[model samples]
Every structure is written in C-alpha cells, then in structure tokens.
Target: MNDLETRQLRYFVAVAEELHFGRAAERLGMAQPPLSRAIRDLERQLGVVLLRRTTREVTLTPAGEVLLRDARTALDAISAAGRRARHAGEPTPRLRLALKPDIDGGLLPRILDAYAGQEAALPVDLVLGRFGEQAQAVRDGRADAALLLAPFDDHGLDSEPLVTEPFLIALAATDPLAARPSLRLADLAGLSLPDGSSADQGPASGWHDRAGAHDDAATASIAQDASDLPEIFRRVELGSVVCFFPASLTRRYPRPELAYRPVDDLAPATLAVAWPQTSRSTAVAAFVLAATTVAAATQPQKRETPQTAVT
Candidate 1:
C-alpha cells in the first residue's frame, strides 16, 4: 500500500480548491515547484493520477475527486483529534457550541439553564458563527456541538432534529410584494436574491439549484459578494433584492423596514444539534442528552416554536 502523509493531503486539497498551483502554493506559504513535486509524488504513491493539467488549467480526475472528499474528512479528523486532546489536558475542560447569531428564537436561555442543572455539566463556551459555519466548527474541533440549519453537509457529523419550521421571504416594507398575504416560489421569478460572501450555502444546492432553473426569477440571484447580514438587509431595504429565512427570524429580529411573507413552496427549515461523529467526550454526550430532553419537553411537535439554538 502507498503511504500518504497528512501534509500531502493538505497540499492536494489546497491545489484542488484553488485549481492553480501558484495560488495553492501561496495559500500554503510554500513555493509552487515544491507543491507541484509533492502532488506528483502523491499520485505516484497512490498509483493513480489525481489531477489533469494543461498549460491553462488543472482539473481533478475521477480519482482526484474521490481523494479530495476523503482527504478533507481525514484532515478534519486529524485537526479535531488534536484540538480535543489539548482541551482534555486543560486545568478545567469546557464544551464549546457553535451556531448562527440571533437565530435561536429564545430557546437558548432555557437550554443553558437546563444543561447547567445537570450534575455532570461542564462550562459551556459559545462560538457564534455566520450561517452554515456550524458544521465546519464541529469538524475543526472549535466546538463540541453545534445548532445547525439543515440541508448542510453532515458527512462527518452526527445530528438530531431539534426544530422544524416553515420559511418566509424578507422584503422591504415599501415593496409592492410586502402587501401580499402569502407568496409562492413563482412570485419570486426574475427578482435578484440577496447575496452574501460570508454566508454558507446552507441548503442551496441540488434541488434548490434545480428549482431556480424552472423560472427566470428563481434563477435570479445576486453574486456572492455581500459581506454580512446587515449588508444583505441594506440591499433589501433598497428594494434591490430579497432573501429567504426561517420563520423564527421574524420573531427574533423584527424590523419595521422589513416585511416577512409566508412562502409555501420552499422547504421548511430544520434546526439540528450536530457533533463530530468520532467524539467520545462525556461532556458533549451530556449536553446532547440535556438538549434533546429539553427540546422534547418544549416542542413535542413538528414546526413548533420556543426552539433553542445552541452552538
């Protein structure tokens, strides 16, 4: 069997993501030639060509595609293992949770209280991340668990359903569509959706992408350039764009400038608690148990309210 080092996988992932040797090398703080040589060595050892290259561009071969996915998982596991080990040696270990800001809809305070009531509860650290970043936080060991929105890549994580709720469209109060009682996906045709660079794709892939193809408005989306939520809101206020959000947001962050309309065609949002698949931490286990117990008592039904968002 060919021996592959973690360093090799790291180099391969950098190159694969950048699709350019120079850019990948720059990102890794290494020279292009050494990075190139290392990838060649990796391919030789594995007995497969991972990348196809020409003068103009480099692309992944079939084997390369498989390796990229596996390599990401392996790299994440290694990183998480190291972080978890270091945390274990601390004077007083703590559990970190990650989640989006202001999306928890008033369930966080109670969950914290309940978890603290447990005999084995550890000090909980909150890691607030942008949307769709919860998965990465758990994978990287920055968090023991996360409150993540569904339709995210759960490849190396274990999750439990905490809350499920329908979606709503956020439009400027002054916009004509704001007066409508309810709207369907067809109503959004040809309108540009708000854009955000820091926003994770969340569940906007596969079926989501296909839905856009059926209507010009469905496919009309702004370029991925908005830096933050406030900026996206600014765009909405200007009547230039619109965005979809969980119904809970209407209660969590109601704005006089914004109007929320029920969207029947979009899939309901599912908030979940997710942890690294390989985690064996007692504190993490206890927290997950505490969270589930609290959720069952509170919601006890689908698409209900008072769901907490824990990170």
Candidate 2:
C-alpha cells in the first residue's frame, strides 16, 4: 500500500468539513471537476471508499470516518512543524489578522503601531470583514486572530474584552425621530434608514424589520455611511437600517442631521480580541499581543477616570 500524502489528507478534510463538493471547491479556491477527481484519487490511493456521494449530498463511509480523525491530527502536526521551522529561522512573529468594522475605536491605530515594531520581517496581514463573520474566520483557520465585539461566545474561542463602547442611534435629517434629542431604542422603533431615497414612499423593503431600512428599488440600494463607526453603527452601516453604534464613532465623525442619541437600555457593545483556544501559533500570539496592547492602553485610561465620592 502507498503511504498517504499530506495533499490527500488536506483534500479529505476539506470535503469532510464542507460536506458539499461545490462548496468545498469554492472554499479550497479551486474549481469543481478537479476537486472531484482529487477526491477520487485520494480514495483510490487509500484502497477504501471514504465518501458516499449522491446527487445532492456526500457522506463519509466508516473507513473514511477513521481516516478523517487521523488526517486532522497529521495535518495539524505538519502545519505546526512548518510554523516552528519558520519561527526558529527568524525571531519575527507575524500572522493574518481579521478586523470587523463594528469593533471601533482605539484599537485600530494601536494594532497598526504594534505590528510595525516587528523584526522588520514579520508582517501582519489584516483582513476586513463584517462583525458577525470575524469569529468564524478565526475558527476556520482563515485568520490568526480578530478584533471583535462580544455577545459572541463560541466553544473554540478564547476572548478578553479590550474595550466597552456606548451605543448611539442614527437617523436621517428629515425623519421625525431625528427631532428628538437623546432617543432610546423604543423611540427609534418603527423608524427605518431611508435608502437615501425620498421618504414619501411607503412600505419599503425590510419594512417588517423594526430596526432595518426601506427602499422601493432592489438594485439601487444605498451603502450606509460610517467612515467612523461605533459598535451600534456597524449594524446600521450594513443595511438601510437605523441601528445604534458606539458613541466614540459619533464624536469622530460629526454630522448635523445624522443625529446620534444614547440608547440607555441595551448593553454597551464589548470590544474583544479573540482567537481559537486551540491555536498556539506564534502568529496568533503576536496578533494577540498587538490587540492586547490596545487593551492595556484602555486599562490606563480607565484608571485615570476621576473618582467621585458617593455622598
């Protein structure tokens, strides 16, 4: 019998994880036919039928199941071995980092500075994504680590809050709700972010959404603005949605009628730096170090908050 190769193991794992050939191919950044042939090659080399393929789905056979577990262990070891070799050759530690737009404030500038001080060779590749997607990226091995806002609790993640941002509501200049100062979530209810369209139009898309947006036209959607966004702002920026965001973003990007008001009831978004608990990559650690340094900065500022005696 021929010894199993790492490429076959990788292909098998990808198929197992996706459970769909088309999706697995997309995830692997390849096309479908080649992937199918590769899977066939892997099965032939192993001398066992690993997958049961049907018109719509794929299932692992018993032999495939056993190989899947062993494959993951071997792949992990191979990846670790390579990382170790790279680390030994150079003291520099750099990794791919993910940042979702929702996690605003002090961290961005600090992350940039932290990675820049690296050994002139170690480099950090920062990937941008939505707030909801960052944790998945880290879990899937697509990113070494991420800066995120919490309420995200995953079995694989190890997270520590770096900052807590206050939520603020945003409204269009012409909206009636914008007339009110310092509105709450209740006040913003029933209001929708206009898709940069005239307000006289009724029952737009996402009308059922109490907190989203409305647009008469589907193809002509507007991109929500947030050159500076807080945690709440992140949600709004994603759609024709009137959502709240962290207060710091309001101060950074001032608008006369893009009114911002404090929402008293909702929990303030907690900005956290997170990684898969199982990851021990130097790249992951260095990414954490850069993000955590932002936390350390947050700490000193917290200590500096003036103490007021409760009489």
Candidate 3:
C-alpha cells in the first residue's frame, strides 16, 4: 500500500528472505503471533497475497516475488544512504570489545597501548566476561568484537588468531620446586598443584595422573581436567595442588599471594579475535589490525624455572 511504511516492507522482506515465521519473528524481536498479524496487515494494506504458508513449509507467492525485488532495492538504497551519513562520524570510534579473564595481563595491555599510540583518535575498551556470553554479544551486535580462546565455530562470524601462549605453573613462594629456574614435567613426580580450574579443564598430561580424589593432596595429580570445576579450585586454595594456566593470563590477572613458573613441555593456548561478519565499522578493522600486530610481536613462551616454593 502507498500508505504503508518502508519498515513494514522491510519486515515482509526479512520474512520472505528466511521463509520461516519463527526465525523471522526472532530476528524482528517480536513474537510469532504479532509477526503473523503484521504480515496479514501488510497483505491487507497491499490488497495482494504475498506469501504461501503451511504447517510444513512457507514460500513466497508470485506477489511476494514481485515485492521482494522492489523491497530489497528500496532497503539497500536506504541503507546506503545511512552508511554515507555515518561516514562523517569520527574517524576513530572507541571500540568496545569483550575478552577472556585469562587475557587481563600482557596481550590486552599491549594491544591497548598500540592502538592508543597508532590511532590516537580512537581508544580501545576491552570488557572482560565469560567466553560464551561474549561471543553471543558480538553476534547480537552488542560488542564491536571479542577475544576468546579458540575452538569457536559459529555461523555469521569471523575469527583470527591473536596469540598462541604456553602454560605456566603457580605455587606459594615457599614451595621447594619454586627454586628451579625451569623444571621438566617429570620433575613434578610427587608434587601437588593448587589451582583447580586449570588443573581439570586444561591439559594435564605431564603434571597430573587424573586418578586421585578432588581433595586428595597425598595422591598427587598429573592431568588438568575442566570437567570438575569445583574440586580443581578447592585444592589450589588449600595450597595442596599446583595449578597451571596460560602464561599470558597468569601475568594479566596475577595472584599476589601465589608465585608462577612455566612448564617447559606443555602446549601453548591459542587466543582468537572474533567479530560478526556483518560489521562494517572501520574501527573494528583498525582494532583488529592493532591486535594482530601485538599477536605478531608476542614472544614465544620461554621455559620457566621457579625461584620459590609453597610454604
């Protein structure tokens, strides 16, 4: 209808594109019932049937086919107009990004400093949160981008590796093994690890055996398991089990009460920069470039020998 707005046409086009009312409703941020009503209203206003729907499938009718092309053209033109207007925005828009708790140390700090020095007009803001929630925020457009440990595979998203960091060991300053500059995994034969989270969810091949109780300090641990969250941190708190973590993370969010050292043979952890493929903001690209540069400059982990011991 001539009286109908471009917004309704846009809504109709989205439903037409997806051909699924539920998905369209979700995208529209409305309930299915209201979406169905809106579509019916649109059809009534146009005085033409635009969709062919049934319980098994939904398809565009001949009328919908005609409307689809026209709607897309109109929407694209409007979007282009908006982008042109947005081009006048500040060249460096402050970028809001999400990050893993493990990155509070070296990697993020270096990136922020690099961005500040290179793009003085744009400042970088890194927000720390759970990985799953952060990834979702990027997809939903709540965040400009995010930094996450890898294994993320999601549609409509893009990711790039930023760093590959190795694991480190942490203990009280009084622990006997702390005196070594760096120790082989085999050297921890009868020693215990204290951090629970890294011990379980992380690789434990050389440090733990995975056969002991959560609180069994005398049994000794050789593997880190993520499956049991509670038990892992508990033992670490009591100073009975030594915990392992990505070296970068440990440096960022350091435990003043604990001393950390590197495990020579453990594999490094990968950190990735992720953003929605739909983003066209120039700031996002600038941030990514700066971040990748820091990744490139990142030093390969060195073998650590401890200088203290658990008291």
Give per-model TM-scores: 0.84, 0.54, 0.47
- TM-score of candidate 1 against the unseen true structure: 0.84
lDDT of 1 by residue, 43-89 (tens): 88989999999999999999999999999999998998898889889
lDDT of 2: 0.63
Best by TM-score: 1
Residue pairs clashing, model 2: 213-240, 231-246, 232-244, 232-245, 233-245
RMSD of each: 8.0, 9.0, 14.2
Residue 302, model 1: Cα distance from true site in angstroms: 10
Ranking by lDDT: 1, 3, 2
Quote the lDDT for 24 in model 2: 78
Error of 1 at 173 (Å): 0.8
Best by lDDT: 1
List where candidate 1 sits over 4 angstroms from the true fold: 196-227, 300-311
Give lDDT: candidate 2, residue 208.
14
RMSD of 1: 8.0
User: Better model by lDDT, 2 or 3?
Assistant: 3
| Better candidate by TM-score, 1 or 2 | 1
lDDT, model 2, position 222: 35
